[model samples]
Structure formats: C-alpha cells, structure tokens
Target: MPVTGADVRRIALALPGVVERASYGTPGWRVSDKLFARLHEQDGVLVRLGAIDEPELREVLTDAWRARAPKRLVAELAEPDG
Candidate 1:
C-alpha cells in the first residue's frame, strides 16, 4: 500500500534529519530548509509525490509520479533554487 500523507509527514520529520512543513497545501519535506519532497492528498492507499527533482524520479517511478502535481509543474520545480 502507498504511504499516507500524515505518515509521510511524521516519518520524514521524525527521521534522523528531516523537517516537515506546509507547502502547496501538503506536507513538505526538507533537509536544512532545502525542499527535497512533498506529499499529496490520499484516500485509502493512493498518493502522489512531488519535488524539485521530480522529473528525475519520474523516470524511476513512472506513473507513480502522477500522485504528485501535474507533469508541467516539474519544469517549474526544475528552476534553480534561489
């Protein structure tokens, strides 16, 4: 089963070094304020993952990335951090 947003938030935050916050209406995961990932709304066991490097992960996870923001947002996320 896919991980739930709340679980993701709790686990990511409780991990050795991960922080969680609100971003785009979902839980944001960061390491030292750098956004590495985020979660989407889920019902039952389906959920999405989004991030600045989403495209790179998309190739690995294939359709699973859809649980995140639309494909176009990937480019926006690709922008260099400022």
Candidate 2:
C-alpha cells in the first residue's frame, strides 16, 4: 500500500507546531519554522524529510514508502498531542 498525497498532507498537518507552505516548487512542511519535510511533484506520494541529512532521510523515506502512510503509525507520531 503506497501512501497518497492526501495521506502525506494529513501527516504533515497533524504534527504539533507544524506549518504547511510552498517552497522550492513543492509543498513543504516545517517544524519550528524550519523545513522538516516536503512533497515534490516528481513523486506522487509521501514526503521528503528535510531535517535529517539527505542520505539518512532518503533511506528512511524509502523504507516508509514501502509501508505507506496512515498505516505507518505516522499519524500516531504526528498527532499534535502525541
């Protein structure tokens, strides 16, 4: 099950203090006003976490890509109260 754009959006928005905005021609999600995630047009689903270094983020995201969203406990972790 692959994550959809909507799922990614939900995850990004649910995080506490997370802010959604457009940057670098993509939908960007930020933590404390610094970019922590983004979803690009090249990829149809999921987000690219920008807080971590490129290689680590890419590797983690690749793994998540297989697990999909909502089902990945992403929503659990993203909840404002969580």
Candidate 3:
C-alpha cells in the first residue's frame, strides 16, 4: 500500500524527542528545535540525513553517478498493478 502523510506523522512522532511544527508554512518534524524532516509543497518529504565526511561524500557522489536501476525492477514498477 502507498504511504500517506498520516503514516509519516505516526512514525516520526514515535521517535524520541520528535515534535510536529509548522516550518516555512509546511508540516515539519524537529528534535530539540532542530529541524530534521519537512514536507515540501511542490516536492515530497525530505529528511536531514546529517553531514558526511568529505571523502565519504565524494565516494557517495561517485557511486550515485554510476548507479542504474535493474531492468526487471524498473519493468515491475512500470506495470499498471505496481
């Protein structure tokens, strides 16, 4: 089943110290007043995954550049019943 905003809220609220608040006119989740997640008006939800080391970030970017979805998985998702 597809997830909804309420599902997101339920999960986020269960986390320790998480609080729901309005951020930039949208729903947001914060811990200790630090914004950790937010729902965008045009885009979908975003989560702050935290800072990564420079070297690790470089490697991650490089891997992303080479990544490709498997044809089978892509076809599955493209099906009407997916």
Candidate 4:
C-alpha cells in the first residue's frame, strides 16, 4: 500500500524532539521549531535533507521523482538542462 499522510505523521512524530505543526496551512514536521518536512499542496510530501553536494542531491531527487512523481513531470525534470 502507498504511504499516507497519517503514516508520515506517525513516523515523523516518533522521532525524538519532532513535533507536528502547521506550515502554510498544511501539516508539517519540525524539530526545535525548524521545519524538516511538510505536506505540499501540489507535490505531496517535501522533506529537507541538509547540505548535500549538487551532483548527489540531483541524483537522489531524480530517483525520488522517478519513483513517485507523474511521468511527465519526471521527464521534464530529467532533461539535460532542467
């Protein structure tokens, strides 16, 4: 089964010091008042992974988009200059 918002909330809140709060009218997870994850209006869930190098970040993001995003969006994102 696909993961749901409830599942994300449960997992996020299980972490020490993590809290559930509103971000731009949507559910977000934070630690020490710093946002870590949010349910985006158009993109579903967004998670902040800090301080990654560009190449590695691109690879990780591309893999994630390929797995979850619509094929059209993934293709657009996968373009050489995108």
Best by TM-score: 4
**Which stretches in model 1 have alpha-carbon errors above 4 Å?**
41-82
Candidate closer to the true structure by lDDT (higher is better), 1 or 3: 3
Q: State the lDDT of candidate 2 residue by residue for 8-51, as single tens digits.
A: 56765655456678879888766545666667757443433333
| Candidate 4 C-alpha lDDT tens digits along 1-82 | 3455665666666444557899999987666566766676473324333334444544543453345445565555556764
lDDT of model number 2: 0.55
Q: Rank the candidates by lDDT, best first.
A: 4, 2, 3, 1
TM-score of each: 0.41, 0.51, 0.51, 0.52
lDDT, candidates in the order shown: 0.48, 0.55, 0.52, 0.57
> What is the overall TM-score of model 1 with all chains considered together?
0.41
Candidate 1 local accuracy as lDDT?
0.48
lDDT of 4 at 59: 57
Local accuracy of candidate 1 as per-residue lDDT tens digits, 1-82? 3434455555454433345677788767765455656765565423343332434433433322223434454444455650
Residue pairs clashing, model 1: 48-67
Model 3 spans > 4 angstroms off: 44-82
